[model samples]
Target: MIGAGAAGLATAIFTGRSSPHLKVLLLDGARRPGAKILISGGGRCNVTNSSVSERDFWGGRSTIVRHVLSGLPVAETVAFFGEVGVPLHEEPGGKLFPDSNRARDVLEALLREVERVHAHLLTAHRVVGISGARGGFTVDTLQGSIAARAVVLAAGGQSLPRTGSDGAGVQLAQRLGHTIVETTPALAPLRIGRADGSFHERLSGVAHDADLTVWADRQVLIRLRGSLLWTHFGVSGPLALNASRHWARAALEGRAPRMTVSFCPGLRFDDADARLVAAARERPRAAAPTVLAAWLPASVAAALASEIGLPDVALAQVPRDDRRRLSHALVEWPLAVEDTRGYNYAEATAGGVTLGEIDPSTMESRVCPGLFLVGEVLDVDGRIGGYNFQWAWASARAAARGLATTL
Candidate 1:
């Protein structure tokens, strides 16, 4: 196994533990493994979600994703963690975190499991290149070289390069004859230009529930509803991060994509207008800002009323056109998103090795025999809330089973 990160660790552990007679050597370029894991979920380490399915992911074929995940479902994953001494507890959105609430505990437990299975993990063995065909393969690393019967590439994607997953695995796969989908930032914060009138900048540090939608040209591409945090840079919460992949992928494909947010999550323009109308009727003496504050923050309501030229008007005194405009702004507010924070801040990568080239049932390369691809290196990325971690575990299990069959 090359790259002893999340998927690499899981794959090595499953392979070694299941087949004790086989010698397992997991190599990682980093001096210390699991940097990403350690930093994930705000250092709590969301191990997996209580609920997961192929529909929770994007990229490649859904059928392929479903097949791989079926090998070890979320139930099995929870059970596996329990078997390794890491009990999980559920949080909002079904995210499961370690009972100890420490990422180090998760990593240490995996490392202990790897040792218990007698798998030899060598750190700092950066694989520079791989040569030779299936029956016999030679992996060249910065530290040294090793001969192996089969190789699993789990070096991860180009997110958080300092964590040691700097797209090296993608390059290695290309040399071995594999089609790579163009990769881009998936769960990354969006950088907003002054195009949106700098309202977001002024609202920095404010968080609220919202529905974010990305449009490709004029078509609605995708939508996600979650907590949105207004950062000094722009938006950095779950809603913006989860919707980033659609924007990044659309931009990479040369399409103009626009992002809009509905502060009233499930309300449409008509619904918001009716709501405002009802509020105005019910409280005729209330000032516009005061009435708007019923649905938004006082600061936001005051700001919006001031920006829309209804700052001092009473709710009933406001014109119908002006009220409708405010409703539109509340429901379909367009954001001038310039670009995302990129891989440096991305939690996962959008595109990777095409799934068509690999057998979904086993994650074995159809182009190159004995070459297994797993984890973020493949064309699979999930929304925030532990979906990507689930992918890592499930795909690793599939690849380990594949290795068992072939080697």
Candidate 2:
């Protein structure tokens, strides 16, 4: 094992338990294991999803994800964690977290499992190079060189460099004749450039529930509905984070994707227009912002009203053109995203080693015998929530089973 993260630790635990006669060694560059796990889910590790499917992942082939997930489904993951003494509880959107609500608890459970299986864990051992053939392999680390019959690369992706995943695995795979897909930051905040009289600058720190859509070359790529947060430089939150992958990919291809957010996701354009008109009649003396505040946040309503030049105008005194403009702004507010916050702020990486080069059932490399690629090192990334962690668990299990067979 070339990492000691969620995937690498799981692989070491399973491989050690399943094949006790064979020794399993887990190496990490960091001083401690599961550095990313400690910070995940706002310090409450989202261990897995209550429900999981290949559709939840982006990049690579869905069939590959399906095969790996089938080997260790979500239910099995839950049961496995329970056996490890980390009982899980489900939250909204089927996200499962340790009942203790501390990421340290999850990591502690994994470390306990590793110790139980008698797996050797070496921290501060960075793999500098790997050279091997079919029968034997030599892994060169900063500490020293170790020989093994098989090797599993679970070093993860380029996201969260502070956690030790700094794209070294991708470079290693490339040297061993594997194709690496162009990687980009996914599940990160989208940066909004200064537009003429930018409302985002004035509305920084505001959050609201909205429907977000991604458009590339006038074509709608995807739609997400969730909380949208405005920052001084960009937009973030569930909706923006979910849509970041599509936007980043489009930008990488030289296509500028536009993000359109609808403040009232449940209301149609005509319905919103009618509602504004009805509110004007019902609260004739009220300002337009006040009427909008009934459904939206007061700050948001004020910002939108100010954007349309009707910040303090009475609802009844508003012109028909201004009413239509306000309705349109609420329904289809578009923002030209400058770029994402990049890998430093990204939760996961979108691309990795191409799925076609690996056997889906075992996660073994077709290009190199006895070499397995698992977790975020492969071209598999899931949405926010517990899906990515579930991928880590499922892929690790699949790789462990395959490693056992080789042993």
Best by TM-score: 1
Q: Tens digits of per-residue lDDT for model 2 on 1-407?
A: 89999999999988888888888999899898798999999999988888899998999989888988899978899999899999999999899999999999999999999999999999999998889965599999998999988999999998889889999999889888999999999999989887725788788889999999899888888988989998888799878999999999988887768888899987778989999999999999999889989989999898888877874669888989889899998988888688889999999999999999998878889999899988888888899988888888888888888887876
Runs in model 1 lying further than 4 Å from the true structure: none
In candidate 1, what are the lDDT values of residues 245-320, reduced to their tens digit?
A: 9999999988899999898999999999998889989998998789878778787777677766764678888888
Q: State the weakest 10-residue window (summed lDDT) of model 2.
A: 194-203
Best by lDDT: 1
- Local distance difference test, candidate 2: 0.89
The CA root-mean-square deviation of candidate 1, after full C-alpha superposition on the true structure, stands at: 1.0
Candidate 2 lands at a TM-score of 0.96
Off by over 4 Å in 2: 196-198
Clashes of 2: 0
